[model samples]
Target chain A: MRDFRVLLWLRWRQFSDGLVYWMRVLGYNPKSSGFFEKLYPLYLLIISSFWVFAMWGFGHDNAVNIGSNIHPTSLADLLKAIPPAVLILQVFVIIVALRSTPLKLSFADMSYIAGSPIARSVPVLLGFLRQVIFRLVIIAGFFSLFALVLTRPLAQNIDLSASVRAMLACIPLVVLTWALGWLLGILRLVYPGVSRWNYLWVLPLLILLAATYLPAPFLWPGQALVLLIYGIAPWWVYPFLALLAIGLVVAFVWFGNRINMILAVDESILHARVAALGLLAFRQPNLLLRIRLQSAAAGRKPFLSLPKVYGFQTLATRAALSYLRHPFMLIFSAVWGGVMAQAAVWIISNELPVQLWIGWLLVVGIAPPVGLLHVFRIDVEERFLRQFLLVDGLQLLMADVILPLIATIAGAMVVWLAQGFEPEITSIGALFIPILAILLALCGAVALTNKRVLQTRILATGITFGIIMVVGVNFSPIIAFVAAVLSIMTLGGMVSQNA
Target chain B: MADKSQEDGPLLKVADVSFKYGSLNALSNITLEASPGQLIALVGRNGAGKSTLLKCIAGWTQATSGEVHILGQSIKQNERFVREHVVLVPDTPPFYDELTAFEHLQFNAQVHGWQDWEDEAEELLRKYGLHANRNAFPFAFSRGMRYKLALCMALLIEPKILLLDEPLGPLDPVSADDLWEELNGHRNDGMTILLSSHQLPQEAHPDRYVIMEQGEIIAQGSPDGLRKSLHIEGPLSLDALLRSAIKSRKAVKADA
Candidate 1:
């Protein structure tokens, strides 16, 4: 217990160090920092207050009315959806290779924690508990807000006790989900064979997704859980969920104390590095990406030899080969396309208010191209390789654009087929994805060949235009087209001058 | 000042190329040239801008107020010409983490549109002791292995001019010797080399030595010429040449 206290004290110091690291990353040394730079976070906080107020006001006004006897369908329907919601989250956890629970220590942390005479398992178990406790606190903050929103409605309609029960249910629900992820991490240590098959876990998720379309009886446990949340299940259901949550946490902590955590620590370093990259990606993205690629685990080399595709075709083919071998680019591109497809489905269903519909459309519309932030980035640092026979760097840039766009279109095609060949929205999405991708690719290439301090600024402007264009698309197609035309004009001017 | 520029156009020419990184002079008034078949060693300590000089020649970085001409044409104006004819293997290999060593060779060959370089590549892989791990990605390979793979890729191109920044910095003694032999083989076949190193190898027999200090070429000549001119007593090693060059330059700078 004393050792655990020491570890927490160490973690606090590391957390402060992390803050300094981020500040340094954002091109600031605290000693040389300017006055305005010091005020930036406070300025942001002031601006964000308006947004916070708006959201809080809406949540308070609307959520409090849920128990009003005026509407039976919406609240009841929401209650029934709770179990499926949890299942979706669990599926997401599995998809990301159970990385939702980030139990990791940096190399620096290892020197302190591992060097201790305290049993190796004590530090690991304590670390896990510390992570879970922090996450629980954040989760509780969100729940308190939700209770503020929903408590009145349930108090008016169902009863005050039901609202209390519902809020209390959030604790075990969160604990179970996180504990399940931790247990998987422990299992990975115990059974490498089973860990290798983790990718296959996605198949059952797709099946569960399909099953949701069927009758309520088929959902079984999930259906029962939903009823329990709505306070309509057998009385034993509450205790059942509580026992399940507590059991998983106990098992994880107990099992953690037995196994050697060196392997887990080693694996966690990779995850931790990737997570760090994700944070610094917004600043010096290219440099961060280069570092990530350089450090990346070079898996089993693919058997495919370089194809004899000549000219710009060769560049495109090279990218295709990379996608095939690496798979992450293809996977993310497909996910972006899937998101677009789902948005299209929802839009076509005509369920949302006009404002919400347009907002969702813009978000999903801009996603695919943004997902391909590094599409034009050749993983190699040797500039000479590209220009050996390169007529123009733009031709090589075009090649990168084509692969991701094709993947996006292919993803949209899959979802289209899955939607039983609905052509109206999906057809437009397929076309839009490529057009936006080309514009983004053009931006990336222009940034590369046309070296300037304005590289980041131009990208920022393009993103601003994209955000505007998304809203414009719903209001007037003419406006959206004008935005595209203006973007192309800007790109042409930069390229013609720089090239 | 002694005129180091060639009378007739040299194979590769750098004239008064100076670079400043925020007032830190990385390279200052660096003038040198290489004939078609010479093995020139660019010897300097770290921060001496040997890599920067190579980068300027290779067109990886631009010099502040000077131009590099290869075969009597500005490299900036004829990038494709330079890319086809010249290769610069940077200190750290900028390898694609996803591509295997063999794939990197295959990729370079295809870019040059060459179809029959496989045998040459295989020979290179064997010579550098990477034949067994040719299919492995360079990311997992040791520092020397990565360097070898980069060297193999550059050699497969068969460039008229080759620039190696810290050529033997990452390699083991055996690999270094193997590479030196391969480099000599290229030199005999009439390829030019400009390599930088902290200190010349004990076994190295460079045709000419260019000693640099604080971003300027302090002295340049054949190994024997440098020893004779500087009045060195040792067996004319590169280390002896460098020491004499550095001492004379410091005394001259002090006088100035």
Candidate 2:
């Protein structure tokens, strides 16, 4: 208990220091601060409140529209989708937990706590609670908004009480899932030999696959929650979920008592290194990605070998081999493409609401696929390595991105074709997929060739959008394609010249 | 006269080069010349513009004024050509995370259009005590090992002028001696080398020492010449030389 308190105090100091650093970066000086400087925290709070209020408005309107008019039949589909979606989220949590336990320790924690005579479970329990609570806040907030959508007070005449009941039910589900995840992850730490089980993370996915065949018990929790949300569930369902949550928490604490601090430290080295970067991690995401990649590939043999080739082909082959070794990057590219395509299908099918279009644009701009320029960024940034390669910037860019682009296109096409648009629209959408993917890649590459990557990326995105909106509206699709091609050449020329 | 000078002139030349970071003058009128087969030690305290000057000469950075010439060609104008002939191995060099130690050398050799480079790569790795870790990623290696790998990569290129910034900082004493010996061998082969260091191995000797302070050259000459001209009263060492240099500069400033 004392150890836990000490650790908490340490965490508090670190958090305060981080807050002070951010305040200073925002031009606040505590010593010479005026009323405005003191009010900065309040300003941040008000901004956050506004964002939440906006999300609430958007969510309420969309929920009412879907329930009352737009895709009224899909409301049943949405209800059915919620359970599987929750199950998928749980499965994802468990899979990550199995691979790398949720326990994250800073360098200070490792130095001060790990080697101490304090009970091993103190740090473990504290870490578990910290993660669980952090995750709970995000999960609860998300499900609360979702609960409002499911209630549909304006459309279904469902009272606010049902929404409260639904939100309450989701809390237990999230807690229980994370508790189970922590229990399983802590057992691996308790028995260090389990950490040696190659590809143990795959077990959760395998169970998910088996659940497709036998969905009775696997999806029972989600189904119960859905019933609870509709206010039709048996009274005992709530008690059952609460009991399960309690049991998982007890199991996690029991296993956590036996945790090997040595193994925990070993597991946490990568996290500690990244956490050490602090704000720098947010500023240079590629640095974070590189650290994670190096950690993932630390002791593993690469699955693919670079072919014996010469010239630009060698670079392309090396890039392809790199992607093959880290197959998740390719999977993520495909997933990104599919999700963006699905969103586009939704917007278009609904007659292209301006709000939806704006949302989609924001998502694409803020979160371009991290892998699109992963290899190219390294190629350009590492001057030591860049000096040896003889290719021009455009050639290097194309070589590095060819495989990921193909995967993205493949994924987008599958989603676009599966949506069953009109034949003409499908063909036209197919044409747009490659162009958009190429443009996104070009935007990222152009940003990477500059020192200010974030600013350049946002600027490039704006210019690209402006050009497409102007040229795409005034001209035919073919002419738009020509304009996009010209834009690509120009951007490619800039990258080459700068590179 | 121009043709004759081009044929036999210094292989590396920095004529009145200066650099600035915004308003801070990092390198001011830093003139240096290095002929083939000569090794020069750029001795300085931290932030004495040693690394900055090396960067300028290697075209990794553009000088604010004047020119860095290699083989009678301007580095700024003929950067690509200059790059092919010059390699700068920084203190903490970065490597591809996806590449192993040996692969780094192999990639460098292949990209440079070398044929049958495996033996040479293996020999370099063995020489650097990294043969056992050849299959390991460079990121996982210790700082000393990473520096050694960077050195191996630079040596494999066989550049006409090699610039090493604080090369001994990440090396052990034995490894440092081995590095000096290896550098001596390269210098004997007519590969002009300029290395920056605050301290050098006691037994190590360079053909010339260029001492700097506050981004300006305070004194430069052969080690013996510097020792004599600086009026050092004790055993000549980097500390002694640096102290004397600063004292002389202060005396000259006071006199003016």
Candidate 3:
């Protein structure tokens, strides 16, 4: 216990130091920024105020109409609907919170902590504590504001006694959500390489959908138990649920502890798996094949085969592969394609005007460039710029910009085919405009900004799209031609400056 | 005592060190310890574990091992001990691209828990004749200036045990001479410095030397001892002697 405390202190110190360093880099002196930093609490207050307002807006009309149609429903129905909604919201919060954990547990930071004289268990425990505290604060703040708005409608529907019972019932569920989030957060830290588990968002969504659609009696015991307790013995029921919540919290902590222990012991296994995937890049066969094909066709000597790429090229290629190989990439393309096809069908079936069809087509054409911006954002967040800088910038640009463009175009073609668009030489020309737009955006992003790439890309896209929209509204071929020329010049200027 | 004399005991020991990629292992057997102040130069061609070993000792690659004990107590067990006792000057200076020589020193001072690093950094920069270009970004500075910056960072740390990998690769003659002078000053302070370099130091100067062929240590001892064992002449240069020794060792291995 003493060792753990000491370790925790050391970890805190390290975190504090790192935070200070980052702040310094960001040009925030502790002495100078002290007042400004304190204003963060004020910022939070403003955000909370806005959130409260939004929630109140949702409930405003409902609150007034609450007593007008007081169909005194059974307690069971109310209990059933509320728990699932709360559970779903709790899960949504948990997934977003857990998503950043793996990134935070980077090797460099871990090495620094591990090398310190602090006890091993302490750092791990402290890490878990930090995440839990952060999650708790966020969850509590969000729900507190949400509960404020909900209180009015809830009060009108139920008597004070029932309101108290429902709040008490919610206490355990909130505790359980916090505990589950903490557990998942630790898992994210311990096994950062395992991306499959990041989709813990699906769990909450499933629980939410199930709660809404599935019959209350069949789905959860908590709701039914809460109702029974409220009816038969409210006092005993609150205590029972409280105890259950405590038990769940205990179980969650124990599970985290067990997993942490296993991770420590099997850290090598995890390391090996991560190394094989991250370092080797061969674990991703499609990417490996592409690299091989590119090398063979380009008639360049293969750098290192599986493991020899090293440094930035390795990281960039891996990023590209991960983005390309994701199942969602295909799914998103298909969905968008379906949307376009549906629009086409609506135009034909409803005998909509040709102008409306042309408008829809233009919107769909603009979609690919807009979509490319999102991909660029993902790349930036993945720290592709750091990796990109390591290689010959042009080669990196080709690998990152050109290859992904090809992949996205292929995806677009699939969407086009799914929409029953017949192949034509001129149909291929439709791709040129979007591709040019994406390239111009990429070049501008690289040249203009020193900030994080994602921020730069998003900013660039916004500006480009804004201009395109303004010009595109006139639907003049001359304006379009001028926009293309300007975009090309901007891209050329950026490339030359970088060169 | 006999065990200490035996080559089997680790030259270095690392403990509880974990490093990662987005989630991976750039390095992790890390338990290593060299003999007391031996001028052991880690050589493993490229990425043959030389840099990683140096990094672990320097506290760059924290021990994914068990514990890094210099003499007995683990360095990882004590933050202050590791900080003041061990120092690492990387092959490339981990300088902020934006910061000039003076600013980097200021940052280093902060990292080392120095209350006033700016003055100290300025003093060091002036002493090293880097004051002229102190305001220049590391990118604007020549390779030699960058090397000087790394040396300056190491000096600010004031470590007893200095770990340098390819320290001399980037420096010019004057800069190299300045480094040797600094190293000599540290030596006078009883500092134990372990540096890895492709270019061998003057044999006449070193207290001892260790040559690594693969991952394994091939030869280790006083420069003269190595010279005698390898059957080299008196006043032989360490670089040529090493080449000859490596050649002979390879021949013997081939015969075996």
Candidate 4:
């Protein structure tokens, strides 16, 4: 008990010190800050509160509108989809937990706490709480609003009862899912021998696949939660879920008592490196990606080699070979394209408000596929490696991005074809995918080559897309294509000059 | 080799070069020259602009003013052409995370349009004691091994002027000696070498020493010439040279 208290105090001190450092970075030193500087955080809080309330108000109004206009059959279909979506969400959580061993310790914790005679359950419990707290709050809040929308169709007045019930149901589901994930991860960490089992992370997918053949029991948890949200489940359901969650937590803690400190420290090294980066990790995700890739490839042999080729072809083959070795990057590129295309179709087909278009544009601009300029960024950034490549900047960029661009286009085309649009529209949309992919790649390469900040890059991408949309809507697709091609040429020249 | 008539001229020259990081002068009016078959030791304290000078000479960084010339041709006007003749291996060299050690050399050779480079690449790995790890990624290598591999890559190109920044810092003593011997071989072949170091191997000797302090060259000469000019009483070493040069500069400042 004494050790636990001390560990908790250490954790608190670390958190406070980090907060102080971040505040100082923002010109608010805790030691000698002026009154105005001290009030900066309060002012930020008030502004953020206003923003959150405004977003909630807008979302609630949209939900009400949707509830009233949506067909009764469609509501039933949505309710049906809810259970499967929840199950899939839990599966994703499990897969992610397995992929990175849920028990993470920062370097400080590994050095100061891991080697000490403290009970292992303390850090395990603390880590679980830290990981789940923010996620629990955010997920419950979103589900509460969703419950309001579902209840609006049946109730004449705004009732907080169903939303409260939904929030309550969501709390247990999140805890229970995370607890299960933690249990599996703790088991893996407790016995070092289990880690040698190749593709252990794939076990979750196998379980999910097996669940498809036994849906009734596999989906009961999700269905029970939905039933609770509707205020129709028996009184025992929520309590059962709460107890199950507690039970899993206890099991994981019990398993944690036997964790191998060496393996745990080894697994946490990657996390520690990224956590040490602080805000830079968020600002420069490529650094995070590089760290993750290095961790993944640490002890593994590469699957492919550069072909015996010459000149630009050598660069192209090397990029292709890298993609082959790490096919997950290509998979992510395809998924990003598919998801964005589906969202774009949803907006257009439903004739939704224009603000959603802005939202889509923001996502497209800010979160261009991670693989879009992955290799190209390294090429331009590493002066040592860059000197070896005799090619110009534009050629290098194009060579590195060709495979990912093709994958993205293929993904978008598949989504478009699945949507079953008219022949002419399908042809036009298909034609637009390659152009948009190329334009996106060029914008990223240009910003990176010019050493622009991320915000500036996002704004540039947004403005370019806006111009294209305006021109295409007001004029002709052909003219828009010409303008886009011209912009590509200009951006290409900039990249080349900078390169 | 590209210009036979220019063989008589200095191989590498930095004429009145200056560099600034924002308002801080990193290198000010740093002028130096290296003739063929010369090995120059760039001795300086930390942050004394040795690395910065090497970068400027390599054309990896453009100086604020003045010129870096290779074989009498301005690097600014002929950067790509000049780069083919000059290479700078930074202190902490970076390599591709996806590439094996040997693949780095292969990529370098292929990009330069070289044919039948396998034997040379293998020899370099063996010479550097990296042959066992040729199939391993450089990210997995120790710091000293990574530096050695980087040196091998630079040597594979056989540039006319080679600039090494703190090359001895990451090397073991024996490896350092081996490096000096190999550098001696290159120097014999007319490859001008400029390396920044606080200390040299015990058995190794450079043709000249260019000592710098605070971004400015304070003293530069052969061992005996520097000893005679500075009126030093003891056998010359980098530490003594630096101290005497700093004292003389301070004295001059006080007099002014």
Candidate number of the best lDDT: 4
- For model 2, the stretches where C-alpha displacement exceeds 4 angstroms are A1-69, A73-76, A116-124, A147-166, A230-234, B1-9, B224-229, B232-236
lDDT at position B151, candidate 3: 79
- The order of the candidates by lDDT, greatest first, is 4, 2, 1, 3
Better of 1 and 4 by DockQ: 4
Instruction: Give the Å error, residue A170, model 4.
Output: 1.8
Candidate 4's residue-wise lDDT over B1-256, tens digit each? 5486267677888899999999999999999999988999998889999999998998788899999888988988776776688888988999988888998998888888888888999999999999999989899889999999999999998988888999999999888988999999999999999999988876767899998999999989888888887778876777888888788888889999
lDDT per model vs. reference: 0.67, 0.83, 0.52, 0.85
Model 3, span A338-415: residue lDDT tens: 455455444554454444544654554334332233333333333211211223334344444544455455554554
TM-score of 1: 0.79
**lDDT of candidate 1 over A1-499, digit per residue (tens):** 7866777777778777776677566554656568987876566567678888787665444444423322445445555665576577666554443432235766665556655576545655666676667766665545444444333444534344543554466667667766777776666565555555635555547746575686353344455544544567788777877898899878877766654456656656665665567455665556655555555444544647568765566666777776665566777777777766666554454343444444554454333344353544553234644434444555555565566767776775677567654576455545454555456555655665544524543553456445545756577655665676677667746644343
Q: Residue B169, candidate 2: how far off, in angstroms?
A: 1.5
Over B1-256, each residue of candidate 1 has an lDDT whose tens digit, in order, gives 1123334578898988999999899999888888888999998777888888998998878899788988877877777677878888888876665567887888778777777888999999999999999888777888878888888988998888999988777988888888888888899998999999875566778889898888999888887788877889958766777788888887888999
Instruction: Report model 3's TM-score to 2 decimal places.
Output: 0.36
Which candidate number would show the highest DockQ if scored against the true structure? Answer: 4
TM-scores for chain B, listed for all candidates: 0.94, 0.96, 0.75, 0.96
Question: Which model scores highest in TM-score?
Answer: 4
The per-prediction tally of clashing pairs is 1, 0, 22, 0
Q: Candidate 1 — what's its lDDT?
A: 0.67
* DockQ-better candidate, 2 vs 4: 4
Tens digit per residue, CA lDDT, model 2, A1-499? 7877887787778878878888776666767658887887788778879998898777766655443444544456677887678889889988888888677778887898887887776666777777777777776666655665666633457355765776788778878998888888888888888988978888888778877899887888889987887788988989999999989988888778788888888888999999889788988888899999999999977565556666677788778877887778888899999999988776666564456666677777779877877888888888777877777788889999999999888889999999887898899889889988888888888888778877887788777755775676688877777877888888889887777
